[model samples]
Target: MPDYKAPLRDVRFLIDEVFDFAGGYQALGATDASPDMVSAILEEGAKFCEQVLAPLNRSGDEEGCHFDNGVVTTPKGFKEAYAQYVEGGWNGVSADPEYGGQGLPPSLGLLVSEMIGASNCSWGMYPGLTRGAMAAIHAHGTAEQKNAYLPRMTAGTWTGTMCLTEPHCGTDLGIIKTRAVPNADGSYAISGTKIFISAGEHDMSENIIHLVLAKLPDAPAGTKGISLFIVPKFTLDAAGEAGARNAVSCGSIEHKMGIKASATCVMNFDGATGYLIGEANKGLACMFTMMNHARLGTGMQGLCLGETSYQGAVKYARDRLQMRALTGPKAPDKPADPIIVHPDVRRMLLTMKAFNEGNRALAYFTAQLLDVEHLAESAEEREQAANLLAFLTPICKAFMTETGLEATNLGMQVFGGHGFIREWGMEQLVRDCRIAPIYEGTNGIQALDLLGRKVLGSQGKLLMGFTKLVHKLCQEHAEHPQLKAQVAQLAALNKQWGELTQKVGMAAMKNPDEVGAAAVDYLMFSGYITLGYFWLRMALVAQQKLEAGNGEADFYQAKLATADFYFARLLPRAAAHKAAVEAGGESLMRLSAEQFAL
Candidate 1:
């Protein structure tokens, strides 16, 4: 079995050394998030994840979720763990205090979430969706709606889901067949089938609040007609408690390759009782409040699974006796040296390490922006944070997942044949990670959103929000003694990023297909440069700490080493993405639709 240990050291290094979460919280006047409180939360949260959830990962995957009739049952030990989760006051760590939350900063909440997710991705899904649902309702729900749902959901007794995907549509919400008919009581009858609903129907929570999207009778056609509705599994009575069974039912659950314990259900809403949360025909925009959160969380899935795989693989490599090193046998007494002595194995391990640590830096940096966006007192600070968040979100969701997939695959490779076995647990990480790139909007969709909607949609304004930071950092540290070369490399890459975007923009103006063709590559290119920026930041921090003679010498040294590996071995991949972006859409489109057929 893979022993999943919390990477608290790394988490702290980023929170304390890299991004300085402590100082930021102080700046935001988050009195409860003192350094001691932060440490206590990290330690306690790690204990819950490592002890409560980690042990259930393999067993849960083996047991999966059970579906009988219209009900769904999560894997064994999940409910108890969930109860412990709520009792421990973890459900609303960063929620509004008005709704029973601790009112902690967003980054702290995200750090806690990382520990939970890294421990058990499947178990995390239940509460994870609840978080997205909570965000949606909190943002769009009226006062009554908040009073009706927020407390219980925040307490973790009630879970929530966003039911958007239908049998015929996934990304295109405009063509959805779901309908909302008005009733006398001011409620609407939501009748539609929603497929791939994560946490849609589960026994873990008392009620499942589904934020469904449907078109009203007088609504306009296409996406503009869509309206958001709150359809609960169990409707509330006058007392606002879960009372009677609603019309929603779990038709079935998916048996999948990964995250089998998570119930991905096919839901049938036969005129389910639903209340409008936002203005009519504005559902898509409101739902984005949840979608963006999910996208970021989904990106964390990649990091979470990759962390699990890397942990498992590292242990296996160090302990598992393999062929002697090519140069010399490091373990002279043993039959063969440990695989860690081998170059190829080291390469695989380093790649996993580089991506995992680099991605963590990116995530924590984004979390810092999230904190500013939510808690900053100044309007200017909030606006800049929002812009940067808007720009980096797609990159976070897409880039992290893409590289996370690579990390997990590399981790599996390091284990060789043992990695393929079920009991070893390496394969499960890969399976769980496979979905990150596909769901929460596919990386391709994220690419288009980055290049098409966010970049072009904002006319380069959003892109500049982030690049300006990169330029300023490069200019300030032009002679970064230890990382002068890295600084120059990043500066050049930052310049090329804007140049390539401009080229694509020019081409897209002439032929719109240019944007489509360049999008995925452009996003990848953007991810590499973005990650490069974080890696540089980390490297600089490590250098400063080393110069200042801070303790934990080995840890800081490893950070420097990994930063070096990223710059030398990984960052160059950005060039290929740039070349693909420059290749244009003609070569891709010249082939006729008939040529696609075998």
Candidate 2:
């Protein structure tokens, strides 16, 4: 079993030292949560995650969620664990206080998210999706809708899902066949088959509220005509309580590669009781409210999985005796020296550490931006914060997930074949982390969104703004000897990527094909650069703390070393992505229809 202790020191280092969440939240006056309050909440949340959810990880993956006769059953203990989760008031973190939420900063919610996700992603998805659903309703739904649904969702007696994908369509929501018809009672009747709906059907909650995207009868063709609807599994009575069972039913659940414990349902809504959310014929806009939240959360999942895997790997490496050191036998009297004595093994461990710590800093910083965008006093500040996150989200989601996959792979490598086996748990980490990049929109789509929408469409304003932030960080931390070289490297590379983005954007305007061809490559390059910046910031902080005479001198020193490994080994990946993007449309566009055929 993994040590599974909350990386409180590192978490604090990121929240306090790197991003300064308390100060950020205080600036917004969003919450009166003090340092002690934040510490107590994190500690208890970590305890719950480590004790209640961590143990279920392997069991959930092994047993998987079951679907029989239009009903889905989660792995054993999921319901009980979920009860504890709601009881702890976790579902309402950063939610509206008027609706029973804690009204905490998004940063604090992000902290809890990491703990729970690292402990058990499968169990985490249930509440995770519900909170996302609540956010969407709160943001876009009418006052009546909020009154009817927000309280129950905040309380976790009800769960929520985003129902967008169909059997034939995933990313191309414009072509979806789902339909919503208006009723005389002002409710819409939604009839659609939604596939891959996480938390769609589960026994953990009394009702499942689906934020569905469908087209009306007189709607125009494509995405513009679509509308967002809140379709509940059970109809609420006049008293606003879950009452009659609606027409929504789980057709089946997916047999997926990972996250098996979270129910992914194929839902059939035959005239399900539904209400419109936000404007008519603007479903995509409303769905973006939830999708963006899910995107960031998925990235955090990637980061958490990597963190736990690293912790597990470090614990195992120190205890398990392996081959003697290459330099000298550190434990000559014994049969073998611990693997930690070996330089190559140290490299693997360092790689995980560097990626995990950088990801933690990045995730929390992004969360702080979420608070700033919503609660910042000035309109200019809000716009800046929102734009910063807009460009950062795809990078956060794509980059963190991409690094997480690599980090977990390194963790598995550290354990040798033991990591490949089920009993050791590293294998499960890899499996769970793998899905993060694919879902919440594939990293490829994220890349296109970044280059096309985030970068090119806006004439690189958002991208440049984020680049300026990175430049400022580099310049501020320029005096830190340990990080100065890497900081310089990151700044130089970022400038190069920025220049390249401008050139590509200009050329892409003349040729539409170039944008699609370069999207993934551009996204991957940007992701690497973003993570490189994060690693540099973390390295600087680790170096400063190491000089401050911390008792955990060894840990801080190791953090600096890992940051070096990231810049040396991982950041080089940007070269390949850049090369591909610079290839322009020729290579990709040259492939004829017959070339792809047999």
Candidate 3:
């Protein structure tokens, strides 16, 4: 297994050069997050992840988490590493200052999160889920609730989880049978079983705060009846410290294909005391606040795993000698040429490179939007940022993860037979990444959300808003000699994206199933073009640096080369998706459920 290293250069490139995040921070009134401060934070974050988390990754996978008699024990070193993470105040990097947080921009937190996730995804889960829970409480919880939970949670002395899935329900929360009965003390008694709860019962924290979803009595049926509740594993005393154990207990932990170190538990709530969050019958909306946060984090998991796998693949390719380069002997002194000398190996490496870098840009861009949404001074600015976020969230979640899976598999393929073995740790990445596309809402559901709700539901306004940005970029660089061709490509795609949406919208209006059929393909198409815009932006910047004779010539040149490879090799795949979107729903629906079998 290769040592996991954070791609600090690429991260800094996106934040400092491509995105102008420093200027963004100043504009957003995040004065504390000056460029120096941000850089320091990133450097410190990199150290913690590299030194503490990376070493635990394989050991965590091998040992997994232990669950016996409702007690959950994390893999070796996890508790101590988490302690260091807490002591460093990593968990509350972006939480509200009133709750003992650093009060930095969420984007800065996301930057650090990407590094931690890449080093050890399983170990990251404990705090990752906590952040999601914090978002929910911050967004929807009452002031008293926030005071009771946020401080300790933000301190990382306590961890949190979102409990929504039941034994019979996953995505369809409308039919959830969990009951939240109103108690005499105004608290609710939550009773039912929640399944697939990540970090649900870990022993690394003083308490586990669960934001549970249950239906209140006399509430409307289906999703409309659902209400959110704060159910802690241990009931808190009047002093706001963990007290008696709650009725909630881990029934069992799942034996999973990967991420075995992260406990996926079946939680049984037997009249667990829970405080209602938000208004009754509006729990789904509140849950989405956390869900969206989790979705973006989940998307980054794709990039994280892909990056780790890419690092391993690149090292192996450079060291593992097989045959001579097609052109000539690149490593003449060796027994044979290194595999990295081969064109196919280079192709695989570049493919992984393009996706990893492109996805990083997308993630960071979305993070900027999040900063704007939360901290923008004006209502219009906030609303505009929110609209764009709504439009891109599904795309980022689905496309990045879908492509992330491809990138990880490519990493394995680059390793050939050795990749399949567990010792190499390449297969671990493949196994771990498999669940990303499935969880946090399946990619299929994300596609439908993108095409059906966000795109057409808004009458193409959301789609237009993003294309307008792309259009502006093209317009700005249209006259540049070096960037003209790339700008032209983006302009063409910008126009085509609008046209494609219009076509899909028109078809779906007549036959709604058309949206379902074209959804995934349309999303992939959008993703490719979306990435194309970022690649061009990066290339334009790299070209400027080169023209100025920047000292980091290799870095800028590589950026330009990767952008060229993306445009020449990867971006063209959008055409196939365009064709598939135009194929309509007939072929998909014609095959009935019975025809799916052999």
Across residues 368-395, which tens digit of lDDT does each residue of candidate 1 receive? 9999999999999999999998999999
Score candidate 1 by TM-score against the native: 0.99
Of candidates 2 and 1, the better by lDDT: 1
Q: What is the lDDT of candidate 1?
A: 0.92
Candidate 3 backbone collisions, by pair:
none
Q: What is the TM-score of each candidate against the true structure?
A: 0.99, 0.97, 0.99
* Deviation in Å, model 1, residue 200 alpha carbon: 0.6
lDDT score, residue 100, model 2?
A: 95
Query: Tens digit of lDDT per residue, candidate 2, span 247-316?
Result: 9999989988888998989999999878889988988878899999999999998788898889999888
Q: Where does candidate 1 clash, by residue pair?
A: none
lDDT of 3: 0.93
lDDT by residue for model 3 (326-357), tens: 89999889989989989899999999999999
Where does model 2 exceed 4 Å of error?
Answer: 477-482, 548-551
